[model samples]
Every structure is written in structure tokens, then in C-alpha cells.
Target: MVLAAEESQNEEPGPAAPVTMFGPDFPFPYDDWLRHPAGLGTIPSRWHGTEVAVVGGGIAGMVAAYELLRLGLRPVLYEAEEIGGRMRSVPFAEHPDVLAEMGAMRFPLAATTLFHYIDTVGLRTRHFPNPLDPHTSSTVIDLEGERYRARTPDELPNVFAEVADAWDKTLQEGAALSTMTQAIAHRDVPTIKSIWNQLVPRLDDQSFYGFLAASPAFTSFRHREIFGQIGFGTGGWDTDFPNSVLEILRIVYTEADADQRLIVGGSNQLPRGIWSHEPADSAHWPAGTSLAGLHGGRPRGAVTELRRTPEGIAVTDADGTRRTYPCVVFTGQHRLLLSTVRCDQSLLPRPHWTALERTHYMSSSKLFVLTDRPFWLDTDPETGEQVMGMTLTDRLPRGVYVFDDGPDRPGLMCLSYTWNDDSQKIAALDPEERLEVLLSALEDIYPSVDIRSHVIAGPVVTTWENEPRFMGAFRANLPGHYRYQRRLFTHFMQRDLPAEQRGLFLAGDDISWTGGFAEGAVTTALNAVWGVVRHLGGACHPDNPGPGDRYDELAPLELPEG
Candidate 1:
């Protein structure tokens, strides 16, 4: 599985510098990047020569590359793997099997950056309407036997009723801390050390378990056995194979704040389509940028290296054989920033590869088993929309999927798993044990169906966790990482490098605040590229990247076509 780009190392290594994200906020103000700039499209770039090189082929990188072209700036893209990073689409190799999504499954309209591209591409999609709702929704918080399904306004009568003090702490006076992310995450710590320091002291005296159960917030939760119900939604609540009652409830009672979002068709479409991942060749240019695709790539030994330059800011892939440019935008992972790019790390210094190493991210893997038969799921007949995914007695394999109408795989279905951390062991698990886990999970979710006896399958594996191509699923800040995030988000990536060296810009979901989600990846890439254009004093923006060109071709995906 080692890719060609990672196969041969023709050059010797000599380090250039260390980079970090410690201080100084550049690019877009953290608050504004979350939403589209009120006056976006007003400052369109009208240039042909302003070009950029972007690293990583994920949504952020691709969107940056694509946006560069839209903004009238040229861009070249570099990727270590296939265009789709973690947000990918997977299909079974055989005919009878259903197409499955191993990465992200949903998208929200609130994700402004992604929404822009979806409109641009004219990709058809269904809306989740509201991420959180009282109807068709139920969440149960069970600490041992005391359990219940969240229903009606009475079930979970607003956490605000009991946690008013805690809620007040979130604002400014009570136990609120310097930052909200810091405040909630530190609920376990004495609310004192952090913002919730005062709350911690109060928490110490009361049994939160009883307090929550008896609170009006949990009056209507009806408990159901959880053991067999896990891992049903492709990635239920198990992040790293470990789950908590709270995490499960969060998924069930999911409330997409200014931070959360989703995709309708899928999440991979935006990231992969937006960036240009080929080698940059001047000969094929139209006074703009030219790029070559990652024809092939794979993991080699321990250290994953690309037969490519640090993701260029001026061109996509810096083809050693092609002409060189001074700028590069990196959109891969934290580790890649240090290992792949040859730059000054002192800009955001913490430790020798320590910041990358000490960082803890949430990750998971899934197996999508497409069946030759329609593995039953509740559906709306008139609209054909998927309803309850698994029956009360339904035994789904590992993940979840709604069926497609056509007979081609009409019986087709998809299942996945996520929020896990044991990917390394997967390369070592015994085959039978893996099967047992898959079967048991399904049996529990759908016991009456005897799904194992009814279905025939196996194409189950997602590299979201193992492959070195990506450092890990988009970097999710650990409980404490939020403290340094002020620097992590606002500083480093936007630096004071000389024009020739402004090649470094971040393009992933690591430090984004509201910009930290999938939508965050969308705008973050735009911000970095636009920042580079302005920093270089080059004419780059929507108006000047090149003449306005619309993409007339697509996968033929439109509601009218469907």
C-alpha cells in the first residue's frame, strides 16, 4: 500500500527551521472567519499572475486551491494521497455490495464556507433541516440501571434549570473562565483553577449523578439497554472505543451550536473537488497557475515522506522537474508541518516535534459492509427519506446506512464505525476476533433479524485511523489543549516571513474556533490563501485570480437529474 510519491527518496535531508502557532492573530479575525465576511465578494481580486501552491488535498486545501482560482489567484495543489483525506467516499469492489461512506456522512447548512462551494459546484443535497430537534429525536443518559430515552420538552427540561449557576459561570461573573471552551471542558476540575473553579467546589459536595437524574432536565429520559445499541450510526458515540453517557446524549440530543455542522450528500465532495493536486507546469498555464495531480502515493516505513516539496504557497505540488515558485500553502497535518515542510519552526515553538507529539486528537475507524439485499431500515414512503435506521430489535452489523431505491443494489446498505483510537492494533487483530466484533455489534442492534445469517459481505476497513497519509482525523483539541489554542489558532500560520518565504499557511481544522469544524476547514483555507495574497501584495481575490469561469461539468448530481 506504499504510494509512489513516498517510495523513493532522491534527495538528502537538511532541516531549514521550526514553525509554531504561539501568538499574533493574522489572516481573518477568529470571530469573522466563522461566518462569511459581511462584505465578502466585495474585494474580488483581478489578477492573473498571482499564483499559490497548497499542500494536502483535503477539503481545506482543495477549497483554497479552487477559491484561489475563483478569487482570480492561481494555485497549485499537492497531496500525499488520493484527493479525499479523512472525509472520503468508499464503495465495495463487487457489484452486489452497496456504496458506503467511511468518513463524514452529514453536512449542515450553517457551515458557511462549505455552503459557498456547494452552491458554486451546484452539487445536489438534502438538508438535515435542524441538527437538533424534539421530533424523531431521543437521547438517553444511563448511569448503570437509571436510564431513559430523552423525549418531549419534559424529558430533558433544559439543563439551565439546575445548572443556572454553571450557565452563569459561562458568561463572565459566576464560574466562567477566560474562554468558554476552557470553562466547560474543566467541569471535572475544581471550577477554581480554570473558570469553573467555583463550580468544582460546589460539585464536590453533591452527587452529580443524582442531581442530573432528579433535575428537570432529565424527567422524560426513558432508559434502553445500551450494550447492543452502540456503533449503529456508522460512528455511534464511541470515540476511541470508549464512550460515556454524556457523549451518547450529545449525539442523540445533538445541538449544532455556532460550532457544529454537517453535509447532505457527504463531506468529502467539498474538500477533494476544491483543490488542484497535480504538479505545477508553466507550459500549460494561461497566465495563471498550473498543477499536476498526485498520480500515485503510499506509506513506506515509519516516517511518511512525500517525493514533494513543502506544500508550496505559489504552486500546488512543487515538481522538482518543473519551475519553482516562492510560496506554498500546507493543509496536511500538524506532524507534516514539522516533518514535511522545511521552514522555521521557532515561529510557534513548543518542543522538538513535541507539540506535534504531545498533541492528543480524537480519532476512530469504521467498516462499511454493503449487502446484496436491503437490510431493513425505517423509511418515509411518500418522500423516501430514511427514518429510524435500526429497529428496536434490529441487528445491524457495524455501521449504519439508508437504502437506495434501484435494484442494482436496491438491497444495498452501508455501515461504518468511528471515534475510536485503537487503529494501530487493527493491523494486528486476529481475523476471527474482528468478525466477532462486527457480528456481535449487529446482533445487539438488531437481535430479532439474525442479520449475520441473512446477509453476505466483507469490504470492511477505513484507514482514517491507520494510514500515515493523514496525521489523524482532523485534530480535535484535547480537554486542556484549548488553553494554548489562542496562540494555536490566531498566531503562527500567519507570520511575518519575507515575500519569498510566505510559503507557510495552515489549511486544516486544527485551530479554528467557530472556524474549527468542517465549515471551519472551508473558510480557514480561504483566509490563509487570501492572507497570503494580501501579504505578498499580489493581486489575489475573487475578482482577479482569473476570468470568472463556472464549472459546467459535475458527477451529474442534481435534484432535477435525480
Candidate 2:
């Protein structure tokens, strides 16, 4: 669809803009991810006097918005960019295809809040890139390997059992270290180092890695070289010294299969539907701004300041637009909170704010290329075109991800990933040469895939590094620090303070989940809602079993005692 080049500066927003393609120049709503697809239009502000104001438009913001709506109250949701915030959607090589996420590629099933919203949207989801999908059955851990194996979900139970068998007896010996492990495993504000310091070396005289590898659950066995007979084969290093890194292993090895799956079609669908009722009632959303502020209109500038209010809270947008409310639950990065938060020149509320400053984050960069062919995907035997959704990860020397941007003509699209530490260092390499280096690495992992050339190449980055507001990845506990996830922030979220203080409350991944995750973000939102409800003279979920308690019925998962 070529544009009719006429007016150089047309006031009217039309096809002249064409909008950035999310995938292959498709005509889907590209501005606000919450407006994805044609099922719903913009929402209108029919009612007035919203009870709360939800800041940030990412996972936490969306979840908080839903909760506010469920409890017969209204909330004005604001975002600086797309509704998915970090989970932004991008266009692919040509026309009709778009990548659905930029930040947070995957999550675990333990996310109670994300699943709740999924069920509410009534959207269908499929297991993500499972070994179950024959199209992708050959799941290669490395790009050059090309050799795909089934997903590891089938091995979850065995992994857990093996880890358990080896250490369970030792842990249950009524020893001081065993008791300490059990304690660290249950708390919200603890870290691997802290736990290790208290529960292991300091107490148990063991290390994390020792505890995991010694367990029978994690070790993998293979065939003994015969095709006919079914048999388990493996090698082992018998040792008594505890490796001490069992906690980190549980994140992937024990929980991978248990992670929640993605929606079948597009992740945008869930947010789009939730923000505005598709096929039912669309939102009262301001144009261009999927969700906007009540008094300040759609947030059009930087949010420079944030503070508590008498009834809720007050915020100043980029344009210095300040408004007051009773409650403000942050749904974006904590940096946003830190940036807008007015800290006294003196010391902060110890261990909390200082700890936040110390929390780490990685830089993220991507290069989106529109190509006539998906250069990385190996040619299909039948179509002679590259396979769509081909994935290349750290396997690339430069570090990147490659997938079809869109389905039209099978144009190629390549995105490279780099941490904040290296984004500047790798700035000199041109896109093509960069692709070469990255693809060479892919070859080492999946030698069969070839990308001799391409249609387009460029870099795309999510500036989490400079955006001090976010601190780091959504909810990283960093290595050796997982406990701070819940403990440190929980105090901030509680609403038991005086009325003057209830004006400000905390919400997001930092407050609820162990790490920066959609689930935690949503859970924090739910708790925020509960706080607001209490403020509104409304009953708690235990007292009121309405929309607020939609997912309260699901039984919570109980982690094993360390």
C-alpha cells in the first residue's frame, strides 16, 4: 500500500502515516498494544469521579485496572508508551506479520495474576514453543545445532524427585542448617547469598550447586547407542560437598513445565480485550492514548513528579501536568516511582530505598530488519522459503534473536540482543556485518540454517539501562539475592498507615512476587485494589466474593520446605 505523496504536512492522521508495522505492515492497531486487532475501538469516558488512578500501562497497570473495575470502582490508566509497556509489539520484515513482545519473553505458571486476567479475557492460549509442536519439534538449544529435541516438560517430575531424594534426608536431619534452609525457602525477603550465608556455608557448611547436582532429579540420561531396546544411560560424579545453587536451578528446571503458556494467537489480544471490551463494550479511552488520566487528559509528556494525596495521590506528567487523586498504584518500572518520588535530602527509609539503588538491571537492544526473505530460517523442503519464527539466541556471537517479521513473501527479520554493558561497545558494527557475526554464531549452534543475505537490517533497543526509574529487569533478585523480592517491599504496600500516608501506596512486581514478573505485578495490583477498597469502605475479598476474587478460588501452590 504505497502512500499518495501529496501534502508534506497534513494535520489529519491518515494512511499517510501508515503507522509502524507491528508485523509485516499489517493494519492492526499499532499505537497502543491494548488496541490490537479490529475487534474493539476506543473507549469513551462516560462515568466520572474515578476512585483510583493507575500509573504505568504494563502488566501491573493492566492488572490494577482490572481489579479497580471489578470492585465497582473506576480507574484511569496511564502509560508513556504501549500498554504492554515492556511487552511491546514490533513489525516484521514485510506486510502482515508482527513480533508481539520486546521485554520479558517468558514467564512461569506460578504467575497467579497473569492467568487471572487471561481467564477474564476469555482468550485461548497454547503451550509456548513446546516440543509437542511438530513444526518446532526439533527445538535446538543452539542455532547451529539445528537438531531439535522435545521440550523438557516431560522430565519435570523426575528432575524434582531426583533433587529431592538426594537432599531431603540431609535437610530433615533436624540440623541447624536444615532448619535455616526451611526458613529461607519460605520467606519473601531473602536472597540466595543470604540464604546460603545463613542456611548453607554459615550453617549447613554446604554450597548451592552441591545440593542440586547431588539430587537424582536433575541428572539426565541418554540411550546406550542401540535403537531397539529402551534403556536409561548416564554418567555421574559422586561427591558429598553441597553445590549450594539449588534455588536458581528450581527457577528453570523445576518450574519450566509449570510456567503459564501464551495466548494462541497474539498476546496483544488479552490486553486489547481487557482494556476495552471487544465484541462487548470498548473503552472510553482517549484517542492515541489507549488509557488516559482523568483530569490531565491523556498523558502526553514525561511524568516528572509523584507523591501521596489526601484521598489518593498526585502526579505530574512530563508537561508538568500535575493532578491529585486518592490512590496511585505504580504499574510501570520502579524508576518511574523513584524519579517522581520526592526523596528528602537526608537519608531514605533504610534497607529499602538503598537496596533498590543497589538492585541490578541489564541493558537490552534489538535490530529489526525488513527482508524479502527470513534469512536465518533454513529453507523448507516444500516451499523453498525460510521457516517462520526461527529463533537464534546467545548462540550468535553478537547475541540476538531471529524470527519472521511477517508472513508476506517470507521477508527476513533479525533482532539482536545485547546487555546495557555492551550496547555502546558494539555500536561500530554495521547491521549487515553485525548480522554476519551473529549468523556465524548461529551456525555454530544450528549449522543447517543459512542467511547468505537479507532485505533489511537495523538495531532496536529497549533502554532499560539509562531509564534509572526501572532499576533493572522487571523483578530480578539478581544472583544470590531472591528474598528481597517480597520482604523489603511488602511493608511499603501495606495500607495500615495513617490517612495522610494512605495517600501513597506501593504496587508492582517488587511488592508481591519474588522477582520482577507479570504475575507479581498483577498480584501487587490486586493487593493495591484491596487497599483502595478498604479505603472506600468496601469489604475485603474474604468478606466480599465478587469480581475482585475471580481467581481466589484457585488453590495456591505450596513450595517444598528447603
For every model shown, the clashing-pair count is: 78, 67
Give the lowest summed-lDDT range of ten residues in model 1: 547-556
Q: Once model 2 is optimally superposed onto the true structure by TM-score, how far is the C-alpha of residue 67 displaced, in angstroms?
A: 2.1
Clashes of 1: 78
- Among these predictions, the greatest TM-score belongs to 2
lDDT of 1 by residue, 1-562 (tens): 1111121122423343111110111212222332333222322334454555666777777766665554445565556666766677665566422445566555543344466666654566653212123322332222223323333325534441333333223223321223322212222212212222223223323332332343443343331113223322222222322322222222221122322233444556655444333322222234433232222232111212222335432231334434244455566766665655444543334532354554555555656555555545434465353323422222323334444444444443444343443444443454345556666765444345555553465645664545566546656433333333334443323444443334456556664533225655665576575566554554323433311111111001111111
Best candidate (score: lDDT): 2
lDDT of each: 0.41, 0.43
lDDT of 2 at 41: 18
lDDT of 2: 0.43
